[model samples]
Target: MLISHFLHGPVSAYPRDYVDGAHQELHQHREAQLLYAVCGTMRVVTAQGAWVIPPTRAVWIPPLVEHEIFMSGEVRMRSLFIAAELSPPSLQQCCVLAVTPLLRELILRAVQGPQHAENPLIQSLMLEEIAGLENLPLHIPMPEDRRLQGICLALLRTPDHPNTLEDWAQQVGASSRTLARLFQQQLKMNFNAWRQQLRLMEALPRLLAGESVQSVARDLGYGSARAFSAMFRRLLGENPREYLNALNKLSELNPLL
Candidate 1:
């Protein structure tokens, strides 16, 4: 069902808390949305892909894009709804955005349900921040082809599996080259790139839940913690330990963040 509410202006904020394991069934909104998790993590699934949003990140979804949300833990969700007409070309597609300090404060202020006259400046700043923010590499695009879909689903179920594209090709009745071409043509990425995204998606919640880096690395099929840390740093600009430490430190220092 569609879960929408009337917005009083071009931008408005909705803040709500969720319990652990909460699930929002498939729904759509009349306006575009920025879903932010202030303290915990969330998994957002859209028709195009899935994104794991930690406290430091948020997802931008275009108006009327069917999606569902799964809360990873006790979550404080702060969301902003923008009038569909105000959505920019850059944000027309569903993607994840890195929430900076300025943006975080803006969201908190907006969530106070500010009056219309006083909202013009805040709305402009929020929109500008969102438009200028770069998309994070937190998305896992889903391929439309049934064969590729099967492979993607299986990998999600057993992300630690060491099956290569060639191995999957043997099992799926397609040549390795064909599988490679399908991934590129349909997912806009190679097999390895897609798998890397999948691994990152799997790692975020585990790390947030206090799993050891070494254990997470081993469970996710990495040869060692060092190798996993290298990959994490290359993609997210921080090693797993550093990333988790920063998040924990921030959480201790500020509740709004």
Candidate 2:
């Protein structure tokens, strides 16, 4: 069902906690949402795609886009709901974004106060900061085709499924060529590429849970830690350890985010 948040002001901040595996049913609100978290991971699914948001990220959801949230682990979310009229034209779609240190503090301050009403300076600064956030490539597009949807859902449920496109095609009662064509037509990517994106998206939560690279790689069906590291570097442009180090550095500077 859709939740109508009749905002008395331009921006609203909400903070909530979800234990691991908790689910927020498919729902929407009238306000554009900037869904952030101070800790844990958020898996946000909508009609268009799925977003695997780590602690350092957030999702910008346009008004009335039906969506659901699945907490990967114990999560504390600090979400901002902006009145649709106050939202900029650029943030009219749902996408994951990299949350900066300053923006995180502003969000926290807003959360520490009222849910919607806020000091004018804080509201203006928050809106300006939101409009400037750079989008991250953390979204995994879901296909519209029923056949492809089945395969995608299965993969999402088990990201470590060690199967090729040929194998999945056979399991889904379609030929390899047909599967490839549908992926291209709908997701605009090949099977391996899409699977890689999914794996990387799922990687962060496990890594944050203190799992070693070797353990995560084995569970994710990678041949070895080296192979997984290589793929991770290629896709994210940084090694897993390095990425975690940077995140740690940020946390040290601002524990609020």
Candidate 3:
């Protein structure tokens, strides 16, 4: 017998608080969850994709979707869980959505409603807000090559280490050309592109944790924050401060920090 818990109406919104430079894990629930980050930065990984959910956006996790979330710095987040039937089919797929000002305010107001009494207006607003979510294409593809995976795991373990593809190739017992080819074949990106993506991914958590851009740059093997910022802008189309601000906003609404 499968016992089910019925969550009638909208679930209450609560804040998720965290300290600087910390990380945690969360398991999937039977119901879908809407996360809004009000402050700080967060990275979420699922079987389908991995997202660096900055403050200007939110992530929708459909019911029964197993996922893991990591926090980079002190985070202020809020979350709401809605019944699966109330969720749109598009949202049933896990993906990151850009949070507009209207949606942000709507979520804040819905969460601010009275705790005891069910607010029909809030429910309606919540549904409207969900309908307005714009799907985004920002995602990191997980590599499948064992050699590439080993290299990536090593870099993740020590993001500050300055190692060129030649060095990585030697460690993996392959030529630089072979590693480059493997990157394109397995990750659909060239060696430099894959490495830059990894560095950018690593930088999100550090920047959100309130680390200075200079500090983060040094940790990521860049000589200067300006250089790092340039690459970040080239890839993400935003400066570090703007990116962090967006991430902080998402953390404010994130239920799981």
Candidate 4:
């Protein structure tokens, strides 16, 4: 059985832990939900495919689609469920949005306020903030090949390990040329692209845990924080520090934090 917190309106906030191997399935509500990861990570699987939601980002669930969320760590989720009529059409689709300072604060404030049906002002502010969600290009792709999956798991286990495709290929008993070809064919991306996605995924959890940008960069095998920041801006259109600061402000506004 699935557990849920019911609010007076279309919103809810609570902590959750899933121990059963069964995925947490929810047939989409009539409202859009902004799911923020207060702690730990959530793996969201939908018809569009699966995406890992680390702490630094939130996943937006639009109305009426079946989705399953799996937890990797203890999860504290602050879920903002908005009425269908009040939400933006764009948010009607499931996607991961980069939470901004203002939007995050708005959510925090809304969560702290009374969950009365009469609170139209809070509801309006929630809708406005939902409209402001910025789509991010940074996303993790599911690996198809068993060998490639093995390689990725190895890399994730040792992110700081400086190893090229050739090194990984040697360990996997495949040539670098073959591994590169398989990555492009199965993952629909090249080696560097896959590596960048993995790095970004790893960076999110660290950043959310309050690690400094320099520390995260170094941990992810980047030579300097500046280089890491440049890649972050190029991919997600924001600096690492700016993203963390926005989350910090959100935490400040939320009494639960």
- Provide the RMSD of all predictions against the true structure, rounded to 1 decimal: 1.6, 2.3, 4.7, 5.3
Return the TM-score for each candidate structure.
0.95, 0.89, 0.72, 0.64
**Cα lDDT of all candidates, in order?**
0.87, 0.85, 0.71, 0.69
Per-residue CA lDDT of model 3 for 1-257, tens digit only, reads: 11123345555454466675556555676667777766666777876547777665678878777777777555566676777777876676776788877767666765564542146766676778787778764556667778887887787688666788999888889999998988787767786776677788778766765689999899889989999999899987789998767655544554443
* Residue-level lDDT tens digits of model 1 in 1-257: 77875466788788899999999899999899999888789999988889989876789989999999999988989888888999988887888898877887888888877673138888898888998887888999999988899999999999988998999998889999999999999999999989989999999998999889999999999999999899899888999888888877655644853
RMSD of 4: 5.3
In the range 1-257, model 4's lDDT, one tens digit per residue, is 23334465655543344442336765556556678766567767765545666554688877656778877655666677655565687775667887776666655555564653236765666667667878765555657677888887777687666888999898889999999999888778887877787788778766776689999999889999999999888887779888667666544554454
TM-score of 1: 0.95
Candidates by TM-score, descending order = 1, 2, 3, 4
Q: State how far residue 104 of model 4 sits from its true place (Å).
A: 4.1
Show the colliding residue pairs in model 1: none
lDDT of 2 by residue, 1-257 (tens): 98865444788887788899999999999889999967789999988888888876799999899999999877889888888898877778788888877888888888886642477888998888888988877879999999899999999899999888999888999999999999999988999988988998888888988899999999999999999999988976788998888766655555643
* C-alpha lDDT of candidate 4 relative to the true structure: 0.69
Best by lDDT: 1
Question: What is the number of backbone collisions in each predicted candidate, taken in the order shown?
Answer: 0, 0, 28, 0
